[model samples]
Target: MGEKDKAYVEIYDTTLRDGTQAEDVNLSVEDKIQVALKLDELGIDYIEGGWPGSNPKDVQFFREIRNYHLGWAKIAAFGSTHMAKYRAEEDPNLRALIEAQTPVITIFGKTWDVHVRDALRITLERNLELIRDSLAYLRPHAERLFYDAEHFFDGFKANSDYALATLKKAIEGGADCLVLCDTNGGTLPQEIAEIIKEVRSRLGKDISLGIHAHNDSDTAVANSLMAVSVGARHVQGTINGFGERCGNANLCSIIPGLVLKMGFKCKAGEPERLRRLTEVSRFVFEIANLPHNKYLPYVGRSAFAHKGGVHVSAVSRNPETYEHIRPELVGNSQRILISDLAGKSNVLYKARQFGISLSAEDPVVKEIVVRLKERENEGYQYEAAEASFELLMRRIVEGRKETFGFFDLISFRVLDVKRLEDERSLVEATVRLKVRGEEEHTAAVGNGPVNALDNAVRKALLAFYPELADMELEDYKVRVLAGEPGTAAKVRVLIQSKDGEDRWGTVGVSHDIIEASWQALVDAIIYKLLKSRRKRLEAA
Candidate 1:
């Protein structure tokens, strides 16, 4: 068998299509094409573009990016079987698939009995006919056509005979490849392996088999690997596991697992760019305007982080004791967090990470670390405020004072109004604040109450801290802490602020968005203050 056929299976990235379908993850056509080109550069085998005829944006994407060349990935256009009882050649949707002018096309068909009768409102025979017609029509018009057996595993469980019959339809219909999709996202790893084994045996190695799993049960990664172990050659997922509901399987985990653990090769003579895995993962999240998952496998911020004394010691002695693979292999790094559970080594490592070298005999640094942990137990999170902790350590250990503190907002209020002159009403804010124990009251107009409050509060502070003049609010997110309605919801606000080269995160929880925004705003200013202090120290 050729290397692509034997050593490791191919990776098909569907992050563009299925991942963008997730709630609140709408990327423009420019974003889609840019990300797709990057994936091709990364040597991904296939990149599934969106359904062309479904929406105007998708249609625009197909039109705008039709001529761009994808060197590595075979761009696959996604759609469903033309409506039931309709001939594929006559269906407008299938025709749109051809009009897109992509080399590959993928269409899903009902494999589960429930979808056959309930979702499609069609007979089993007609459902089979739909799968057959869709694949056959695209087969002649397109170079490659893949048939997705939606909910195939579950459908097989509900009615194994019927599911097998559907697979036969795709086979007879000239599908270049068949993917078993866990569309409902409920199948387990063992089940995936068992059923894939059965399918491969029944299909008799006549065609390529694929696995497309969703992470409803958090087992999507495991199930994908299990399927690969059984015989599936192609694996489908959204990058960073972005998808509807739970999510599709995370390609971040799958790619490294295949290359490093399962010994799959991307291509011979190509430098192993698998090390760029984490970088690409973060880039995709940035393009999608989503926060990177700090706990995600391989690429997450805490992927190889260790804090326990014994574990850190063991890892420092030999990384293999704690890390499954060296973090550098995936473009990640080793992190040591400082907490109450930390030992002497943890403090030393953390200090060094901040460019401070200390010996074990530095009793003052040790005492300061313990005191900081004590305050952390009281709800002061220094992890997001490393620069703050460093300054505090310097003040305690080195007695370096002569510093500056920014203004504090004492209280603020947001009032809503509806003026007859404007259809889009605005919110007004009032604030009474203090700077270094001096009093100042300010009011500002803004699009919303929270915006008005933020402007007012910052206006009060920008005087003392001129850097605040240069800062911009990158992102603001609100989360409800309790399941309640009508002025009862406790809310949390997370704010990201960027000033020149420095970006900081601050979080606040309160019963009011204004109050929460105030806390977050204050934290942001303080983070900037500490950051400025650290820079001064480094320069000195």
Candidate 2:
């Protein structure tokens, strides 16, 4: 079937408005504009900029975003109904929505009687009038005006007649679409389906309907899908599910659920745009300065990572055996994790990934698996340290006995000098290594023992390998393993290194923290040297 022939649903993203309400999620005006541009590239139907009346940052965003042209999305300004003390036309909040000059305007109003009585502290009749007046005042200025019936599900349950009455007021006020919001996020999928059905029955199918859900109950995605099944044509959510409390519906999960699983269509569901989903998801997290949630469905690093031997074996033959859909469809790739759970199949699969062809029956593969499990039992984690694992496999495959062929560690020492009169401690490290069978000795001083050791080692290797100049230590992490040793427990060190073009991870474990760090650091240097040599060979 053609794209035009499928049932179409509108994807309205409020990441800038509602998503920023999340704790620890704060975006500048420029960040908001960049996110809107990204959403436009993803083919979103509407991008809620923010409440211009609420903050100067949002107002600045609405101004700056006007300078750029969006390919697909229409900009929306979000706000609440005007206060009861002022007429809608005379209200500053309503005026700000009009002044934003956006093609779309969304205003939310109290739907639950409890909110009207307790929150708004206004009569139910007055709240209804505010909903009607605010939307009506902004209707002509906006190309599209959407009404959000806040707490609609709870409102319907509290007073079905009043909740249904709120919809009537919005319709009378010239709303282009009425979005039913599960504000408290306590509604279930079954409840969403039943409530939407009842709304459709009473309000008829002529009026446009949308669903806005929160994830307090962890059912925002499911509730959004359920609302779609019950005739909601518009779906509202935020990227990565960011919001005030638990979060709004996650567009990352909802988009694929609607298109791939349910056979519905939207602009983002198009093949080309869908492939950018993972990139877009990571980009937002980067801009937010937050760590990406690796377990997020469809767009996470661990989403399709196979760890179990049996599962990896099955998926190697056919991805459908383990994956619900092809990872490439969402621009993500399958991953094979190596650990104690790894089998011969896992070893062969990883070898292939590293461009080393190996058969399932290879004795070297069996040896590698055995050694890997033994290392893991000793607190070594290869899942995040693939470079170290690859080096181990190469050594086993080649039948080499030395720890590393590039260099050999003879001995190293660190000393700290402190005085009672001085508040700071001076640290120094000395390293001796044989590079190409030639012994090289170096010494260096640094802020700490690890830094001094790293500097000394690099100084020692720089004379033999000029390419080591470009290599940098990106991140270092240490974890103490649980054991009966108390403060003397074994520690694992994971080091991340990058050489401008490529990055790799290596790990080492020992009872001494410095020794563990040195082991990882040595693995990192060896990996870099080997990678540079491979590239040079390939070029030749």
Specify the highest-lDDT model's number: 2
Model 2 scores a C-alpha lDDT of 0.88
Residue-level lDDT tens digits of model 1 in 373-467: 66544333333334445555655666654233455556777889887875877788888877878888988998777678778877777776676
- Candidate 2: list runs displaced more than 4 Å: 1-5, 339-540
lDDT of each: 0.76, 0.88
Give the clashing pairs for model 1.
Answer: none
Candidate 1 stretches with Cα past 4 Å from truth are 1-5, 267-271, 338-540
User: How many steric clashes does model 2 contain?
Assistant: 0
The candidate that achieves the highest TM-score relative to the unseen native structure: 2
The TM-score measured for candidate 2 stands at 0.65
Candidate 1 Cα deviation (angstroms), residue 410: 33
lDDT of 2 by residue, 160-226 (tens): 9999999999999999999999999999999999999999999998789999999999999999999
| All candidates: TM-score | 0.64, 0.65
